[model samples]
Target: MITVTLDALDLSALLCSRVCHDVISPVGAIVNGLEVLEDENDAGMRDFAIDLIRKSARQASARLQFARIAFGAAGSVGATIDLADAEGVARGLFGDEKTKLTWSAPRALFPKNKVKLLLNLVIIAVTAIPRGGVIDVAVTGEAEAPVFVLTCKGSHARIPAHVEALMAGTPESGTVDAHGVQPYYAGLVARAAGMQVGFAIDGDTVTIRAEPAAV
Candidate 1:
């Protein structure tokens, strides 16, 4: 097993890199749209720029919302966040991409650490479906001790190897950059919460489960 030690600064840098990567496209689009609106004299072209600006702004907002909860202290401030809110954030995170979601969580709230883990797993599912697919996220057991199960299956589904290495804490590279940050953080959160996280990948499917701490 490979041990990786990451200080607070290292984690912050990698996480910021991840967020910046996700945010760049939409923000760039917004900038381009503004430039087009300023330079284009045609009314139709200006209207097109306006539409692009709106769409990109919304996407940026969604990504920020998703990241704030998934990778930041957004949930920590409140101790727990509502399931419905999490679902909404999940929906926004995927946008109208080829990936779809079927949420089966109970209509209850989730603790901050668990919520963060759940969102990280959701990101894992989203990345698996490069060619598009469905991610079914379900939670069982009581709110006081919830178990989360997420299955993501589709054509060409794959969980990035760096993420797998981080989960196992056996990175051959001896270092984790942006690719492994999410999973590493998720694992830390799970362990800190006295939870166990497991994953099984078979063919074009990946199943991720998180069980509550033993009594």
Candidate 2:
């Protein structure tokens, strides 16, 4: 029988905790909004609450879907992501805006884990742009092992350095660094996956790739 080290198990739990901590804010907001709507008595307030609930729900769903891809167990070999639903989730992250999100993927349950990771990463990419812009998300599998790729390009300024290191899994400690410059919890997630993550920045394009562990 193969035994796992305590450190390894602890690291896995720590990573999972990080993922939950990162996602709880958006998901918790949805729950809180729902509670407020259930008890509020004002008509205008109720309408506002409804919008918040919808927005929060979409946000929570997107995070969950993204988590499933990034950290959850991968079930089957070939699965597809629903482009329309994905677009809706992507749009939800941008709030009520004119951001255009174009999803090019088959409509099916592709690999659950891959889809989750891609969704989270894409949302992270889009969130970096505040002024709203066009986003294209695509997914494909390779012959050797399944692979997922996300390419985000916007006319907004270049990708932030911290984010670049986070995607590349090379974050410095906030306390020791000159600035509180560690990547967000999500970047810690990419690192925990034990996958080699890479970032390519050219002109106005920021391409990120998170590949599954090679077997």
Candidate 3:
């Protein structure tokens, strides 16, 4: 008899895909805003529109840069990155938005791949709370292993069920939206990287933890 076991490694990839899925909307919004701002008329309206474009663009860029490390792909081996750079990516994403962010991580604990996945999920969680909320992110890993813990809380928890299901690796075709797409892509990436993804809901909040698997 053979039994299959899905570990944290699998979860990481799944969550990475989920991260990609969720980011498209806001990213697209940034693109649209840019197009509108190009020929924007009216000084007052243009200023207002510029501010909106800047904020959205910042958010999109932050999410994409972070996701590249988290969901899309990994960086070069032993590539040393500035501590402030990592935090800056997160700050750019978490700041100037309705969501509040709190982060804690040791120096160079995660590889580029892990960092990207973690940051991607951070943006996803923060966005889940549109009206304003709090997001907590922590990084932990070493030569033996590494992991990330992400928690997002808000007054109204409106995370779609399909998104949660995607995180769990059970996605449906009809409900496959941007949010679910990220998880689906993440699942693929995680499999390639040998990692796992885990997700749970707490009251009105959701938490996801991802880690690499042992060979």
Candidate 4:
């Protein structure tokens, strides 16, 4: 059996779609807030509108910052980033979502590839639990081959079908859409880092790992 993959352009398209999908909600909330403030004469309601705008603005900014670092070429070549920064971004991305994050990494800088892989793995894990749950991320091993383990658990924790297909290098369809591109990108990034990826799933728990610590 053969799986469908995304080409460069298709991948680009899907990434764009995903970014837009995430950014739209917060931005739309800001607009709604503005409308509420304009139409509401009650002081309390106006205050509520203001709060909504503030929260939505912050969330929008957080998501954008996370996406910039996670999805874009925001860092210099061969640069290492602070793990705290990644954790903060992850927290911001899950704002108001039912998911919780537990990070078990060092405070030191991590190679850009490893940082990216960690974030992508977070995305995959977060998306796996639609009913909300906990995400535990850890990093260890030699710097040359840092190993990462991501565990996702919740009431309905499970890997996405698209991710499974991409991981196996054989998607069920010919084109990789936005909803299925993160896993594909994660695998690609893992390989580029001179690492291998593996996963295990048991009932409500799913684990993903990257080996040979990326440089």
List TM-scores for all candidates, in order.
Answer: 0.92, 0.57, 0.64, 0.91
Global lDDT of each model?
Answer: 0.85, 0.56, 0.63, 0.82
The order by descending TM-score is 1, 4, 3, 2
lDDT of 4: 0.82
CA shift of 181, model 4, Å: 1.5
- 145 Cα displacement, candidate 2 (Å): 5.7
So what's the TM-score on candidate 3? 0.64
For model 2 the TM-score comes to 0.57
Residue pairs clashing in model 4 are: 3-171, 145-212, 145-213, 146-213
Deviation of model 4 at 11, angstroms = 2.4
Model 2 C-alpha lDDT per residue in residues 32-100, reported as the tens digit of each score: 878888899999988887887787777667656545545554345454454455555555555555566
Q: Between candidates 3 and 4, name the one with more favorable TM-score.
A: 4
Candidate 3 residue lDDT tens string, 1-215: 12223455654655656666657777777667676678778787677777777777777677777655555434566543544467777787666667888887776644554455565576567656667788888777662266777787887765645554555456655334444556555555455455776777777787777787666
lDDT of 4 by residue, 1-215 (tens): 58566677877888889989989999999999999999999999999999999999999999898988788876788887788888989889888878998888878787787788889888888877888899899988755568889989999777777686685557777556677777877777776777777778899999988888335
TM-score of 4: 0.91
Model 1 residue 79 lDDT score:
90
Error of 1 at 214 (Å): 5.6
For model 1, how does the per-residue alpha-carbon lDDT over 1-215 read when each residue is reduced to its tens digit?
A: 76887999999999999999999999999999999988999999999999999999999999999998888887436498788888889999777788889998877877877788888889877777788899999999876678899999899887666776786566788888887788888878887666887778899998888898676
Screening candidate 2 with a backbone cut-off below 3 angstroms (N, C-alpha, C), the clashing residue pairs are 66-116, 69-113, 69-116, 69-117, 70-117, 79-109, 79-110, 80-108, 80-109, 80-110
